[model samples]
Target: MTNEKRLPPLLKLALELGPLALFFVANAYADRFGFAEGQRIFFATALFIGATLVALAVSYALLRKLPIMPLVSGVVVVVFGGLTLFLQDETFIKLKPTIVNTMFGAILLGGLYFRKPLLEIVLDSVFDLTEEGWRKLTLRWALFFFTLAALNEIVWRTQSTDFWVSFKVFGIMPLTIAFALAQTPLLLRHEAKKAEEA
Candidate 1:
């Protein structure tokens, strides 16, 4: 993709986050519009599927390439969301986070087992870190993903559907952003060390 055609940060964030916001809104009003409980969830799942496709399309159109993270997420969303609507079981959708997070954690940690820091590939465009820094950051993220997977299982199994939906929409994103922000000092320190070596 040409630099000029690349999506700006704000627009990219919107593409990634808009579908989730739509899902939350759709679920919130599903009942007021008289949808039955099952149908409400089905409606929200359907909307999520459509919104994910739209977001991916917009990303490709503007950036000329699909982002790796969102592409994986979009695929899972369609698959699990389809199963949820097809089986009329909310369990499928609720299990999506657990599956996705577990997969990510495994991929990252497995890369470390092979002495490769896969996070460097994912975030290299945004961060410049020493080799040790990449290893540390990758380990931290792997643990964090595992924690999120466990939390998803607990929340979905114990909570009401609406509560789970709210947690998915409101809870996860903030936690991720906060976690990323908390690593800023580590990131800056590593970048400074790299600069000194250069």
Candidate 2:
């Protein structure tokens, strides 16, 4: 028998996304726990932080190492989570995504300024592409993440909490699917070339 133990990439992605799902659920159900408004926010933040840590552990077990992007994301979760709990404010927790996405966008776009494509480094295991291809792919992801940040601000500012929760689950996920689908031609082109070379 073989010694293979690692999980597939897509499964790993699902596991990684699981914590965010849990965070949203915990926040939505906050009142049921009979927590005070400040307590509920703190409790939810604690749960979110715990969920992220657990997700990170599971991901590491499955993949043999922490995925860098998710690790960074988890760090933000914990940091913002701590701040939210300390300040007893929901605003800090809510702003976490904006800070994260904006930071990612800045780093990505800035890498392009230095004539480097940082996405290739992070996604190297999942996809193989040349420098130019990596550059384009990186730029696309940078823009997409920044767009998500803007949309988060818009939704949180204008909508009810319930609506934002629904959008966080239903809206952003579908957008991700559609965006990934749009990249199919790019993946296929590289996949075909790899096939030919093999």
Each prediction's Cα RMSD? 2.2, 3.6
**Superposition error at 62 for model 2 (Å):** 4.1
lDDT of 2 by residue, 66-105 (tens): 8678898899999988888887776777788788889899
> Where does candidate 2 have its weakest 10-residue lDDT segment?
1-10
Clashes of each: 0, 0
Candidate 1 local lDDT, 1-198, one digit each (tens) = 122445788998898889998899999899988898767878888999999999999899877888777898899999999999988998998899999999899999999999999998888777778888899999999999999999999999998888998998799999999999999888987784566787
Which candidate wins on lDDT?
A: 1
Model 2, residue 93: what's the lDDT? Answer: 74
Output the number of the TM-score-best candidate.
Answer: 1
- Give me the runs in candidate 1 sitting further than 4 Å from their true place: 1-6, 192-198
Off by over 4 Å in 2: 1-6, 36-41, 62-64, 190-198
